[model samples]
Target: MLASASASKAACNQETLNTTSFNYVNDIENQTVHDIAVKFNRGVCDIGRANLMVDVSVVPNVGQTIIIPGQVCHPDWTTCVIDGPGTNDCLIGGPRLYYTLNGDTMWKIAGRLNMTLDAVTCGGDSCNTNITCIDGICPGGGGSQYTANETIPAGQFIKIPITCDIEPYTFSAGVYKDLAEKYGSTVGQIQMLSPTYNYSYIANEGGTFPPIALAKNCRLLSSNYTILS
Candidate 1:
């Protein structure tokens, strides 16, 4: 419920974009933050240009008290992953769920949000969403089955697997050792999904990895960190 900005700056704040999106409570002239970023598909991240009372003529009158930023789509939009610039895999929007607090893991919570590690350990079929069954002998009710290096505790909700319009490739500097010898995969297996950029800092900032069959859905963590970097 609180730990959103710790894990080494949340593995690089991957588009929870300083997190928040309540999804309701309109007042900006009866709801005008692009109608709360289209009801809640979110993208407004927020930036009043400079605020000379601009945008929708500077809303906040009808009721006054605008803040909304606590919701981001994921009741299961058919368990997204519309790769290849199609439009579905959160990228920087949301496949949102996020709950865990105390030093949350899962590859720094899917490397903040740039997602990888088999899409947060849910992999191809995309996991999470058990619901805990207990009486039924706990199946979906108990949820949080997790695997890949497991740990994730806090409140444990996590289910972010987004993928809209594909965008995650960074292999600069002599081109990631020649794309790891043409996708045979090495260079520490492409830095196990690039936990925080490497390969000479993504070729001195030019960046462009994710190629070998979508970087082979990485997520190779073992030396976790939530801060104290």
Candidate 2:
């Protein structure tokens, strides 16, 4: 179906970061998934998979939010939310590199990536002790070290701890139980992976979550070992 409004007016004009695979766009007017996909220069299936939308052929409700994949920021921007080697290639978890965006804080970064503040601050189980910040403000700097809540400037790359590689998921109208079933993960593990949301609250559905980190079937190899021993 065609969009009721002009495609140019309904275009996905949101800000994006480098390597940031998923982006959120609000539907100001009536449009089908195909219409939105065409505006974004992507396939309907790709958008559906990224957003976990059930129907790709139907027209979306007005003011509905949609997720677009493979959209990127300008080439000059160094900021990004690195999602690892994706789900296809098996790899080990370690410090994932994330370049800071303007007005970005450790907590915001963790929430944006579906990670815990501890993981972003290098104090959690996912952090590799051997790998520390080489360019940005790190955990320890005698007196200049910034806390997770402090704002970090753009273009500074930071190392984030990870237990396993991850794949992104957008939450629909579902609880943790539904999310766990969909991803073949336990509710507790999912909660840990996404600590930004309080488990007791059920109204927070239809939001984006940190990419689900892989625990099983990880293909370990010498090349995945990017950390220096």
Candidate 3:
């Protein structure tokens, strides 16, 4: 119901990259379909609302394989564990640009949007400030991370991240308020997206994931032409 979160978050999706294989082993001797189904239920939350491709029936044995999810995996992230709060699912979405007005501070802009410094910065430690570049919206030389004191000139477009949460369940490691705050949303909104622990007496059921949980879908178009020899 928070429409101000914008359509820009919905503008991009990532191409499935080839993964370096990783999986957890169910070393028990007689693992059944039920066992794997329990594991399958723990699959990645597809960020762009895509259907996951599963192939467990073909190899229902002691050495079950599960591909680690996402466009890329970090060095520390290796195996899919039981009830893990581990997957860092960020969509490959294009930033929505914001223009700097006269006397605009990076802090002010970030604060207004509830965006983290990590979201808007150009990335890397230092940005190009030469050629008369002012503020942290340093265009060129690989944009630097946002700094608190950057004095942006008027008419400069700042890149704002289209942040999204793609993990299937609420990962336990993060501060709940930060996530809600970062997206300019509420903790209830986050709770609404993730599966929650339920009480035994309540007859509650989970609805489909909130559409806002994902980044806007992105696609790539490629073309090929054959020239007459």
Candidate 4:
């Protein structure tokens, strides 16, 4: 009986060892499976890398819209509060060059600028019509008419016709002569039309009054002549 009892105790000890070994293997397998699942989840959510790029040079002028790429962070870095290029709108208005004339006819301004009437009026109404006549009738004239030039307010602004010449760039009697010759006008007529220009010569440049003939040839590039009150 004693031998049989000892054998039974040994068999029970063996059974316990077997159960512990199986449990250890199962625990290790479960841990490995958990680690793999965690890694798979991270991979699935990862955004990886972005190959997109923004080219600022391609942006169009203002008032025009453009489509920009979207990223994990806002792709419009220019507009973003953070990580933005900088403040102020990136797009800008188109190029605009304008000139104001004080005379009524295109021919007058053309003569002033030393340009042909056709050249100055090439753009039609906007180039040739007066600012007042843009919407309302011109004062002192009939038929809802607009002047071909801007109505400069007295003492508000001065409009002068300037000419770009190759030699004697400064305003002088010789320059005036060149202008008159080019524009088919008399020196006296030019002097009468632009008396302010003559005054500017005495006041600003401190030069003696030039000959009326040379003054006629002078081409206007800029003028210091101001409107009178």
lDDT of each: 0.33, 0.41, 0.31, 0.25
- Cα lDDT tens digits, model 3, 168-208, are 44222222333444544433223223322211111111224
As for TM-score, the candidate ahead, 3 or 4, is 3
Model 4 accuracy (lDDT, Cα): 0.25
Per-model tally of clashing residue pairs: 36, 1, 5, 16
Score every model by TM-score: 0.19, 0.27, 0.23, 0.21
Worst 10 residues of 2 by lDDT: 74-83
Per-model RMSD to reference: 18.3, 17.0, 20.7, 34.9
| Candidate 4 per-residue lDDT over residues 1-229, each given as its tens digit | 2332243344233333312100011223113211321332211011111101011111112232211111121111121011112111100110011132222243333343333333333322322221212232121112112234433322222222222222222333223333445554432234334343321213123444433212323323333221111
Model 4: per-residue Cα lDDT at residue 209: 40
Query: What's the distance in Å from true for residue 74, model 2?
Result: 31
Task: Specify the highest-lDDT model's number.
Answer: 2
Q: CA lDDT of 176 in candidate 2? A: 42
Deviation (Å) of 218 in candidate 1 = 15
Against the true structure, candidate 2 reaches a TM-score of 0.27
Model 1 has an lDDT value of 0.33
Superposition-based RMSD of candidate 1 using all C-alpha atoms, in angstroms: 18.3
Candidate 3 Cα errors over 4 Å, as ranges: 1-95, 122-146, 162-229
